[model samples]
Target: MKLMVSFSRKKVSEPIIARAVMDTGVLINVERARIEPTEGDVLIDVPDESARTVCMKMRELGATVSVLRDAIIRDEDECVDCGACISVCPQEAFSFDSDWKLSLDQPRCVLCGRCIQACPHGALSLQK
Candidate 1:
């Protein structure tokens, strides 16, 4: 599952994430992270079994966490399989099958909206 964690400036520098990783024994894949003086945001992929523990630990450390479900969606009917999104996806979420059909690895998607914008047929969208 994917989690979006927001940190206040006061708690931004804490090693809470490291602790969570060590405690949960799960490899948390950080897809995106942005830190500034006032606030920070991190998008992470957590194992299903450790999601609850990790989220609780994050909240205890004063970071707000939200679960992101279906962050990206594709309309099969609308998609022309032009490979436009494939070229722009930073995560390589979009790919071609053996038959050259477009496929999407939803879990690898970071919801960056690059695929949505790259789709000339307007077949992709980011779900809120």
Candidate 2:
């Protein structure tokens, strides 16, 4: 399960995420993060079975937590299998199949937005 955890100014210095990890014993894989002193957010993936527990624990620790169904959206109609997205994806989420067609592994995306920017046809976008 994927989760977006947001930290406010007061929670910035707190070891909230670490505490949640320790309390729930959930293994969190951080996929993306932009953290500074005042505020920040972290995109993480935890075991599906433990996602709920980790969400509750993170909320209890003063984090704004929300489940994420997808990090990116691809419009098949507009994409032309040009491979531009594949070239810039840091997570290697986009690929070309044996038929020379583009494919996407949505879960592998880390919300980097590189694929969207690289697409000439505006077929890819960050999930809003």
Candidate 3:
């Protein structure tokens, strides 16, 4: 329940403030200020106790486990501007470009995954 979400940059003297939460979901917007997860970051989905164990293991391995989730977000980018996604989202998580293409507001998103289903373009997933 107390998993941390850290931003790790190799060259930076200090990583930015990390986010730790006890939530069930996260945002999937790849636009501005998005904390995109990479391959080496640890993902946990078990109970809170198990998550603690995993966090300890991650720390032992010199990796920081910043947040815990029951799922990993794999978002799709096949947006063709049909505008179906923007309409269904209660949070207005998606927006449009000048060309009418779709862009995401990652910080404003809560990763509800509704955009994935609402998409006629199949532009969202929970894979990575």
Cα lDDT of all candidates, in order?
A: 0.86, 0.85, 0.49
Per-residue lDDT of model 3, residues 1-128, tens digit only = 43443334442223222222222223221222334443222222335556565455445444555653433243445656677778777768677889887676654454556777877766666444
Q: List candidate 1 segments past 4 Å from native.
A: 10-13, 22-25, 98-100
Q: lDDT score, residue 58, model 3? A: 40
lDDT of 2 by residue, 43-90 (tens): 999999999899888887788998887668889899899999887988
Query: Candidate 3: global Cα-lDDT?
Result: 0.49
Off by over 4 Å in 3: 1-77
Query: Order of all candidates by TM-score, from best down to worst?
Result: 2, 1, 3
lDDT by residue for model 1 over 1-128, one digit each (tens)?
99999988786566667877887777898889887778888899988888998899889888999998878888899997889988798889889999889999988888788878878999988786
Each model's RMSD to truth, in Å?
2.4, 1.4, 13.1
Question: Residue 1's C-alpha lDDT in candidate 2?
Answer: 80
Look at candidate 1 and tell me the lDDT of residue 48: 86
Against the true structure, what is each candidate's TM-score?
Answer: 0.80, 0.92, 0.41
